[model samples]
Target chain A: MRLADLGERSGVPLATVKYYLREGLLPPGRRVNATQAEYDESHLRRLRLVRAMIQVGRIPVATVREVLAHVDDDSLGLTVRLGAALWALPHPAGEAPGAPAEAAGPSREAADDPHRAAADLLVDELLARLGWSAARELGALSPAHRALVATLATLHRLGYPLDADDLLPYARTMEQAAAHDLDRMEQLPTPREQTEYAVASAALFEPVLLNLRRLAQCEESNRRYGL
Target chain B: MRLADLGERSGVPLATVKYYLREGLLPPGRRVNATQAEYDESHLRRLRLVRAMIQVGRIPVATVREVLAHVDDDSLGLTVRLGAALWALPHPAGEAPGAPAEAAGPSREAADDPHRAAADLLVDELLARLGWSAARELGALSPAHRALVATLATLHRLGYPLDADDLLPYARTMEQAAAHDLDRMEQLPTPREQTEYAVASAALFEPVLLNLRRLAQCEESNRRYGL
Candidate 1:
């Protein structure tokens, strides 16, 4: 098929198709003449894959080009290249703050920036502290801790700055205060209801953080005014 | 407060602080003279917010600058600007192809990029198809639709190359096959076990997509060899 035909079939514009060709994101079609080129099913497949990486993965064009280059290299597995590229892209979900069990295994460093490295360490410290606090207060491997650990692991890799050390001290302090908060939140008396409350609380962690920040600011202002 | 002091407080290094200053992600403090500068708590807060935006939000420096500018504009409500900035960043959770309830209400043309507009339409179509499939098979307000909608909204705003008319048919086909596959997997007669399976399935969506590409390639080669 010619460029127009390919564009029609792919539902992309001819100009955009030409741009992709120029960018080397799309391979050159067989030349029929100075004004014409023939594309095939492989072109269609490649186009779809490019669209998926760009649209679904939200990868930058430069990075996408590098990924395509790596995938086309016969020495590398396309699957591995694709996975690495996908991993490099920012996740669509909100960032979590700790590494998950699946991510705990040996993996190549996805980033080399020193700031990111420092941030990762901080997140690790926060998780450790949270783990310790849970063990001390709730008797070890509490369902909340388990859930948080899993969530954190996923977020940590995705690049959330949550140092376990900094967070541990803060979490310990919050844990002590939060018990009272939880008691107030759950006016019900059953263990099952409490478990549900715990689940809901886990989901509301960000909002709780926001509220805490506001309260702390208010308290500081009150103290300044001798209120 | 020297560079080292700022570094220690922020958990970022002197070198990284220098980098942030160069990138305009951090402002320089009052000069203690030509060779040194003094830092303060405001710098510490800014550094932490920068780290959060870059590491957790995965926002590029240009986008981060825009957010920072908005945040610093005192006329704007801090909470509203922060929420908008967060909304603009890619979500860390994987795309929720199953969660339609999370979908943004209606589409608006904000930017003038034709490709972006087309991509938004495509995402909407994909989500609509996914929603229809989930309603038909899994019942109303399915988790999968909610997840997909949330993911699609983020992907759409990020200028992915999806066009609604192009992806709708493909999504419908994929949803049909996925529904069949999931039905077979759920045939193991235990209601309590189904919840566990659903949770596992939700977590493995990305891995499954990764493997599906591999499976398709393998099948293609097998067919070529008459296997």
Candidate 2:
């Protein structure tokens, strides 16, 4: 297939495909002649994935490149690839990734940023309670860990107290979701595909969970406050 | 407290506090003299909430204005206030809110956007399965409804298969979250405070849930593919 057809079949515009290729986000096609090139199924898949990362995941192109690197690196183990993929995305309003490993006094984040210090403590307690090995190994390097820390810190900063007991339900139920998500990913034939599924789930299905939570919150409010 | 104190305590800058007042994101402080005004505890809380909506929620100022309007309207019932608050947040990529209520072929969203149409069906199925009252009343007008529809549409457009069964666990677990959230809100003394809590939850706590899911997904991957 030609570049135009690859763009059309993937539902990305021609100029955008050219931009991606120029930016090294997409690989070069097979040269068909002096003026044209042919793309295959893998090119089509890559184009769609890039578009979703940018448009749906709302990840910057640079971060998309970082995440794709993890997906494409076959030397990494399956769990490791998925861990790196999750780590690759940016954490919103959290302490910078790979920062503040030392848990004691005078750490820059602890000294300069109390929210992060408090968040770190909460994340430590949550992980300790759950005893998840991947997150334990990845620790502060994982964007997921930082994001959780940051959010808990946000709630606390706003005067909403969230103890480990308050968060146990969320942690336990998310384990169920994680198990379901992994059960599906493990059934896939390739390790790369499994990592891809994890990445896609992060972008695509998360909104589903969030919206459902919002919808259910409406129900609970009605049950409590209808008069 | 004076305007300066309000700004200092909220950690919002004096200029930004003035901007909020100018933009009507904050109410006018009590006029103490020709040049200055006094603020109160409510002003402090409102300032914090507005800052959280903008900084933590990443909501645009215009949408914050819209949501604040709902929170300030005491004439509305408690559940009604929550429903309106949820409705006021932006749906990332769904159909225009308040569009395509008919569910018939001639609706503009149905005619023009198959994703919105497909999303409508999925939301209907999920709501019917749960039989939630507020969502049932609000229907397509709700931002939660539109966001769910939009996200499902995104997954489908990206060629991911998500059945109602795939989404059931998310909906059910979110009900547990919603119940916990609402129980907390119900204990607050004021209806207005309850709505404020709902708005805050939508912004602040959602990240915690999402990151936990990501952390758990890593654990699942490790359990299966550790080598």
Q: Which stretches of candidate 1 lie over 4 Å from their true place?
A: A31-35, A51-62, A74-227, B1-227
> lDDT tens string, model 2, A45-149?
778778877877778999999999999999998777888887787554422223343322222575566766776777778778888766777776666775677
Model 2, B97-142: lDDT tens digits are 2333432232257557686577667777878887776687777666
lDDT of each: 0.43, 0.76
Q: Return the top candidate by lDDT.
A: 2
Q: Highest TM-score among the candidates is held by which one?
A: 2
DockQ of 1: 0.04
Error of 2 at B36 (Å): 6.2
Q: Give lDDT for model 1.
A: 0.43
Q: Please identify model 2 stretches exceeding 4 Å from their true place.
A: A1-4, A28-40, A94-107, B29-38, B94-107
- Angstrom error at residue A150, model 2: 3.0
Q: Which CAPRI level is candidate 1?
A: incorrect
